[model samples]
Target: MSVMLLIEQVLNGLQYGVMLFLMAAGLTLVFGVMGLINLAHGSLYMVGAFACAGVAAATGSFWLGLAASLAAAAAAGALVEVAVIRRLYDRDHLDQVLATFALILVFSEGTRWLFGSFPLYLSVPEVLSGAVTLPGGIEYSLYRLAIIVAGFAVAAGLFWLIGRTRLGVRIRAGESDREMIAALGVDIRKLYTVVFALGAALAGLAGALVGTIQSVQVGMGEPVLILAFVVIVIGGIGSIKGALVGALLVGMTDTLGKVLLPVAFGTVMDASDATAIGSALASMLIYILMAGVLIYRPQGLFGEAH
Candidate 1:
């Protein structure tokens, strides 16, 4: 590959990484603070994409659709937490998993009922539709670059929220000891709801942003959900910093592996065989990276050893 091509692939990796960060960050927060294993989190992601697509289609404003996505996802998240998740806090992981898995079905069916089964397309906003030239004269998608910037911005905001704000203090405390925080007159239940909603909104934002590049449709979040889980595992559960780092690592490994591995194999083997082998290995790269991380640090990169 030429230098420019390599540079572009790196940028693509970064963009993909940030998107995973968006999903993983929220997931870690919910697990970290609430001790609840929510398998249905991806449903909120779907909610956001559908909301953005439906609203933007009706109003012809991508911005409005984006806002709606946040609002709708957050609302749906809060509702789910109040109606179902709160009950799962004291239950075992198996119970939480079962309940949330049921929620996945509910969300999938509800969304299908409302929107039908057709895939919806979200157009790139006019201002973000074209390619932009980088300093090295590399052309890249402006919207994807925007997604990277937005993801980093959200990461910074989350850091601030968890480290600097009063709510942050409570979240940290809750993570360490929920019973103590509740004894200290903190309404742990309310905090859990807020955290859940925040996580949902982040997932929704990710779905909406990614929807423009891919088709917005039912069951889309399930595949991404699996990757998000891998990200959190590699980063160390409950660590935002870990999530971002892990996301970038996985993204780079997956993207570059796909691009570079075939070339490396091509030098030694027939082109067709190299392509097939490279593609197969590339698909396994992220999971391999996760397993490596676990071997090095079973608790995850940033997860505290208990």
Candidate 2:
């Protein structure tokens, strides 16, 4: 409707997209480097949330909770990699999917057992508890803006890590040919573990960040996990740049569709019908985009032509 409203929605979409990027970034890495389909990645996200909530509640410090979330998720990830996932690495896709799917059940049940079915709420820190005025005189939440900044920072960091560092080189080598990297004296197993842990840590960070805004509860990671899958698929399975672009595209498309479509349809139809139609289409918008992308570029927007 108004310019202010439009800007607000755009910001909301950006924030949402960045969060998806966090999830998708790790997912793409795992798929690209390891060729493993981890269905339990979302469980790592849940693990981070519960870890954050528990620590925050116990210590009365959100920062401590955040740290705990990362540690817990990373440790859990490393453990899963060594114990179960290692076995599945050379297995078929169905086996990997089944094993990780089992992990999702295990993590969810264990979380429910430890935390109970009740949801946990995190308090926004005092410094980030207020709103700030943006350039257009629009008031926005400091916490949300903080999320946007943090997400971008991570993206930059990832770019540097993958593009500049020795680890990045090793990772690229591994992706191109695992056997060759091992032959060249690289500890391929160790590299895979580190990558999985790193990806899991990213997912954890996302969970901790989102936990404050949403409920920290059992099975909360599934929907986000699904969206993350859509992100990776649309972005191209192994491309970080594609993940970023696809996430933003999906985020903005979904958000704008929900808002603008309803308004546009309302002018030509009844309010109830317009709202229903808009909401339905909005939910499907990202998937529709994915289908379109796949039809045109089977590998994805950033995926290498195969």
TM-score of each: 0.99, 0.99
Deviation in Å, model 1, residue 155 alpha carbon: 0.5
Model 2, 153-260: lDDT tens digits are 999999999999999999888888999999999999999999999989989989999999888999989999999999999999888999999999988998999999
lDDT of each: 0.94, 0.93
Question: Against the hidden true structure, what lDDT does model 2 obtain?
Answer: 0.93
Worst 10 residues of 2 by lDDT: 297-306
* Candidate 1 vs. true structure, TM-score: 0.99
- Report clash pairs, candidate 2: none
Could you give me the TM-score of model 2 versus the true structure?
0.99
